[model samples]
Target chain A: MVAAVKRATQTLLLAVTGAVLLRMAAGDSYLRYVNSWMRWPLIACGAFLVALALLDVFREQGSQDDEHDAHVPRAAWLLFAPSLVFFLIAPPALGAHFAERAQSAVVPVDTSTEVDLPPLPEGDPVPVVLDEVLLRAAYDDGATLADRRLELTGFVSRDKAGTWFVTQFGMNCCAADATVMRVAASGVDAPPDDQWVRVVARHVSGTGDGGREEPEVVVEQLELIEAPKNQYR
Target chain B: MSESTRQDSPPSTSGSTARRAVGLPVQAYVVFVAMAALVMSQQWLVPRLDSPALATWSTIFVAIVVQSIPFLVGGVLLAGVIATLLSERALRRLVPASPTLGVPVAGLAGVALPGCECASVPVASSLMRRGVAPSVALTFLLAAPAVNPVVLVSTAVAFPDRPEIVLARFLASLLTAVAVGWLWLRFAGRVPILHRRSTHDHDESTAQAFLGSVRHDFIHAAGFVVLGAMIAAAINTFVPRSIIDGVAGNVVLAVAAMALFAFVVALCSEADAFVAASLSAFSDTAKLVFMVVGPAMDVKLASMESGQFGGAFALRFVPLVIGVAVLSAVGMGWWLL
Candidate 1:
């Protein structure tokens, strides 16, 4: 009888888990809304538990005989009790404190190459690394071409007067392993730290003073923008 | 058919009658509610905790639970089918008699069939019923999740820069599993729970047995998975990561910390690599230990163990695996990357 009951419970749980996964995959708005509010993974777990419950129900009805009668130990139940209690109470989200401590202090970049001379089409976005910007003038041959403007969008990673680096965080698994990829913006309005923004700039010639490894972006304009929904890659 | 005739009498005892009337229904209701509550809570909680860190953690947790469901369903079903279709004599013949050979073979079998921690418990139980040596069954239980192809592949993917971590995890988990099994056979006596008679005396047909086994395995594994997820969710909510980090920093302290993490996290072997990778602050060794030990020893595994092997056996066995796992992880970390 005990075995039957256990099986029934397990079936019910499995069915529910499948349903929840389906819902999540379907992009249920409520689920998405709640995902924004809490953690989506927790929702996924809840769904799995429901599926398990359903599996249990099915198993109980199907298997009348208890050929596999393994007795559950009291100690195992005791061990499981505390975890159960904690699940009942929803925990807070990870905060900014982790962000500061988790920041990778060392930025590893190769600074040996110096490639010069490529004119971008009008209004085309030019990819500039910090090291690349330091080698030559921001603009080729010191001439500000007519009707040319570069527009770029990224998060405000670092800020200085008239100069800042727009950066994005790339994630492999979770936020815990996020790496920052930054681009320098010079000749533009600098925003507050960590604010996502759009910058409109005219490429200025590089000073050639900054180390060949650390190039700077020279922006002619900058504007702050709202942060995107998903910050990590 | 013969067993059915014997059971028709109902054994005519007041205690047995009361147990039949009250025990089954009460247990069933409890299981039902437990299942409902766990799923409901997980659904409700996950969305409310949104943050990149929280989302990632939750995603890893969910993926683990989600990915393993199919396998768990299959394993439980297979076990149930075996129970109904195969006669005791047939099963005995299928399993090796000798403890020494059986245990190591079972442990090595884990290298082939990778399952999540929850799935393994039921599989282990099924093996016990087939008359495989308890020690051997135990070895398979510990090693299957860690050494399986899916988990190994996932580990490799998670740590693309370091391939050696995958090899290290496989060797360490395999060693721990075999070592524990050998120890159990040498030290432990005959376990009573495994000796319990088969419940299916009805002489059900092969097809029925197959369906029944599938249903049974699904239910059994599903319950444990839910239970495990709830535990992990609870830990994520209440236990601060700082505490985990603080404890996991010391080389010796990290092993014990990971053992405890293994108990609480209940991560599937395939998804555990991501979780391990996410803990960038933790030393590679500690992380490796977490991957190796989490699948083998955890609260979910303990529940399944109690259900399958009997409480007395689980009581001694889980801790034994945990200790060996920690030692193996630490020792391997020292020798390897």
Candidate 2:
């Protein structure tokens, strides 16, 4: 009886786990946790687990009786926790709350080759990645960003001083290694915390050296937007 | 079916009455109800709970677990192959008897496993269960995530200007692995965890043994990963990194801080170099310590090690790896960086 219960529990756990992975991978929800490239690998892994569970069932059925029940440690049951948490919490992507804690982080750039800053493409309110805006502001002596209106999109985050900044996380592998990038938006009433927004702004010179203090920008326009498909770059 | 029919009778008359009322055994009925409750909570109860801190914690926790599962699955599949197919004679031919020779070979062999630190624990444990030397297996465990080609290339990419940073990381990690393996050989008296076997039942067919080994390895390793991820996520969320950054001025303190940061954040080896490089406050040597110490020992890896090996083994092993890794990174940094 104990052996049967154990086998049934294991099978159920594996099937549920695989099903959840497939469900997450089949939709955009997985982008909240990992890189987009991981979709196929996740699908493959889920399929493999489900097949393994089925194999276990068939193998057990073919056998006569449980004489030597394989010992599964109590720790194995912890496998259910992830599934339980996923179903219960439905965790969103790392956002304003996470960015608030990890504020004003500098993205790693190639410092060895100091090349000329690329000229901004011919456009008013040029759409730019938040990291590049900060990088050019800090490192480019030419002040390439001066007199150029830029368009930036990020979620809203506020520091202890109640200063609002447009914040985005740059992820390398997963959310675990995400780094915060912020550009302070002035001359505007702040949107709701964690609200994704698009801002057309020009750099506010003399406000930041981009060391600990993030560069400031005077917002010419602000529009609320839904979170992007991929929240991290 | 026969076992359940013969052995599953209720213990009491009252229990039997309830079992008949449910039309299924109590255990099965309870499991069904619990699952249904969990599913229902997703819609009705969980949404009303409004705490940003808790939600952030859950996101990070889920991310770590979800990110690690694929790598863990790959490791167990390889371990399953090892458990069923590899013969003791073949393994003996591959790994030399002398610790002096075998340990270095194992460290070099870690280059083959091009995955995260989470993957190496089960593979290393499987090696030990197959009668490989514990010291040698431990060396592979430390080196696999740190010295693999993917990690090295990622290090190079992270520190694009300083090509030496990549070489320093590779050499330092290898040195740490070998040094710790030799230390364990000399100091470890009797680790019962190495002797505990999850080898296949002799009566089972080869296919059954393979499947069973995969399941066993996956369950043990994955469970510990969840435990580790919870602790790591809590620390990552609660602890302010600015406190660690404040110590960057002093050389000794900076190195220690970086090592501690590496252990707590528990970043993947492929991604950690970028993180280390981003901390512009620290010296190059301190960054080296972050890269070296992360894959060799971290909160997650320590938890997994304790689960695979024994708690006593992890208690002894974790600090030793950290100490050796710090020394190695410092020495290599002075030489190469």
Candidate 3:
């Protein structure tokens, strides 16, 4: 009976976590945690986990390895918590809370070719990531961003002084490595914190344009939209 | 904690009578009730999760767990394959006779096995049982999880712009493994590590045993990983970032702080690079210390060593390796990184 319970717990833990990742990968759900590149591995491992669980379930009943049951093994029960968090809570993507806590890695002002920054595209409202907006503002040559109406999408983040910034994070591996980037915006009604918005704005060359401090984005338009399927850039 | 006492206690007459009265095994009934209540309480918990601290904790916990599942599966699969394909006698022959040569050889051989510390535990125990030298077996145990290809690739991905950090991690971790193995060899007389399990249980066929071991390893490792992630999340969320930010500017202080952080948090080697990357305030070298020290020694790993190998091995070995690891990480950070 102890053997049966052990087998059952292992099966449930793997099978459930695997299925959750699979479900996330098949659609937009996985984007909440990891990037799209991880989808195939997530799906493959999910299937593998389910397969392993099934094999464990159907192994020859009497073929149990004759090792004695260990301690009460309450520890094994903790394995179920991850699956519970996934299915029950399935918490929203990284929000303002994490953004405030995780300091943005300062992008150096070198503007060297090594940063591999791409050329800004030509459009009335050129769509770009918030990281790109901050990068070009802080590091790009003045003319590249001069007079261009760059657009970016990010959730609202507010500083202590009641000023709002459009911000997003770029994940190196998972949400844990997500680095926050923010471009302060004004002249638009404040969206409540954590509400995703697409900002159509351009660099304003004024007193604050030292290219070292908070790079300002003149908010020409602010349209509230549902958060993107994948939150990280 | 005494497993022998918990082993299959045959259902005596009274045991069945009580079980019949409850219409279920008491153990099963208790678990079932607890799970039901826990799941039902989600309604209450979900409302509170709106708080930033709670929500942040939940997200970090979720991320770490999701990130590790693949590597955990991979670890078990690799261990399972090794178990299914290779017999004890066959593997023992691969090592040299002299423990001196075998120590470094086994340490380097770990690069071939891609897994974490938990997977290596069972593999090392089997090696000891097969009459392998304890130094060689212990070296393989430490090295297998740390220097594996999967972990290195993840480390590279975590620090994409700096290939040298990856190189430094490999060299430092390899040096630590070899150094610790030699230390074990010198101190073998003072400290003896008896293999935990003693018996012949190969009666089951290879396929049965292979799947059984896979299930066994996955359940065993995943439980610990989940526990470790939860503890790390709480530390990550509540512990002021100021603790880390305070010392980021000082090289010596930063290294010490990150090393202690790695030990207390006990993150998995595969996913630790990501966590280290998040601490961008710390220099790349400090991050190097965190990575190098983590797989070789951590609070959870120490306790696990005590559980499997015994307190004598764990108590003595942990400090020796920690000291060696800190020195090697600093050395590599100065020279390579």
Candidate 4:
């Protein structure tokens, strides 16, 4: 009876976890947690798990494996936590909430070595990553962004001083290792916290001053926008 | 723990009577209560997550778990293959007879397994059981998760411009593994490494055994991964960077801090490089310490090592590895990075 119950629980755990992975991958919801490269791998993992569960179900009854199954620790059942979190809370992508708590300013870079940055593209409002704008402001030796009007999109985050900024997380692997990149906004009232927005702004000259302060931008145009499908850049 | 002990015991007369009376085993009752609570808690719990901090924490927590699953699964499957296909006779043919030579060879052999440290514990334990030298097996355990190609590639990717960081990590991790092996050999006479065979070694078919091993390894390792992820997520969420940045100026404190941080995070080696890369305030040498110390010895690895190699062995081994790993990283970082 113990063996039978163990088998059933094992099968149930595998199936439920697989289903959660599949559900996450079936849509863009997975982008909330991991990079796009992870989607296919997650799908494959989900399928493999379901297949394993099916195999367990069809395996011969009272098999020799069942006698040895008693050794599996009860702690193994804690594997359900991820599935439980996914199905229940379904936390959204990291946004202003994380950016505010993580760091109020843009991620710092080495300033001793001057960076020879390339010029921005030929457009009145050249589309640029919000973090790249901050980087160019902080590190670029040529002052490439001094006169340029750049279009950036990010959620609104405010520091303790009530200075609001447009911010996005630059993820290396996943949200777990995400670093913040934010550009301070000027000449506009702050939007509601966590509100995603697009802005056509000019980099305020001398604000970044070689990474000492966050690069500030003068907002010429601002528009409320929905958060992108993949929030991390 | 109590439940596990109960499961191991034979069905007593009272247990049988209890099963008849309840119409289900005690295990079933426990599982039922847990599942019912989990399902019932959803509605009550979901709405209370109104705080953005809590939401952010949950997202990062799930993200770590989600990002790790594929690699963990891959590791478990490969471990399953190794368990069934590899034998003691085959292993004996491969490893050198001389313990001195075998230790370094075993360290080099770690490059073959591309999984995290979680996957290496079972494989290393099995290697010892298959008649390999304890020193060699321990070396492989320390090295496999650190120097594997997957981990190196991820390191290279994390520090795209700093090719030297990858080289430093490789050298430091390899040096740590080999150094520990030599130390273990020297101290083996005094130390007791209790080797317990797996509880059930059934004469089952190869395919069946492979599947069973896969199931067991996956369930066991994934559970530990969850535990590690929860701790890591909590640290990431609550621990402000100002506290970490304060020590960046002092080299000794910086290296020690990074080593302690790595030990607690228990991140998969493949993903740790990204984290180290993100900690831009630290010196290159300090970051290298984080990378080297993490894969060789961490919180989760210590627990898993204790579970596999016995609590006595882990109690001694954990500190020894951590010390050697820190020294190796500092040495290599000084030389390379």
Candidate with more favorable, higher DockQ: 2 or 3: 2
Per-residue lDDT for A3 in model 1? 36
| Tens-place lDDT digits, model 3, residues B1-337 | 1122223334453354344445433454555566667668878867765687777787778876677677667766766666666776677678898989998999889999887676676677656766788888889988987899988999898787789989999999999999888988986646878554321235555776677666666666566667767877787678877776798898889988988888876667777887777576688789889998999887667755665567788888888888889899899999986
On TM-score, the candidate that comes out on top is 2
In Å, residue B210's CA in model 4 sits off its true spot by 0.6
2 versus 4: better DockQ goes to: 2
> For every candidate, what share of the true interface contacts is present?
0.07, 0.54, 0.35, 0.53
Alpha-carbon shift of residue B67 in model 2 (angstroms): 0.7
Model 4 has an lDDT value of 0.78
Worst 10 residues of 4 chain B by lDDT: B1-10
Global CA lDDT of candidate 3, please?
A: 0.72
By lDDT: ranked, best first: 2, 4, 3, 1
- For A130-226, candidate 3 gives per-residue lDDT tens digits of 6556666665343457888888888998876888878887776566556677887988888998999988887766412323455787889889999
Backbone N/Cα/C clashes per model: 65, 0, 0, 0
Docking class of 2: acceptable
Measured with C-alpha atoms, the lDDT of residue A126 in candidate 3 is 90
Q: What is the TM-score of chain A alone in each candidate?
A: 0.45, 0.89, 0.84, 0.90
Any residue pairs clashing in model 4, and if so which?
none
Best by DockQ: 2
Q: All predictions: root-mean-square deviation over Cα?
A: 8.8, 4.7, 5.1, 4.6
Sorted by DockQ (best first), the order is 2, 4, 3, 1
lDDT of each: 0.58, 0.81, 0.72, 0.78
User: What DockQ does candidate 3 score?
Assistant: 0.36
Q: How accurate is candidate 1 locally (lDDT)?
A: 0.58
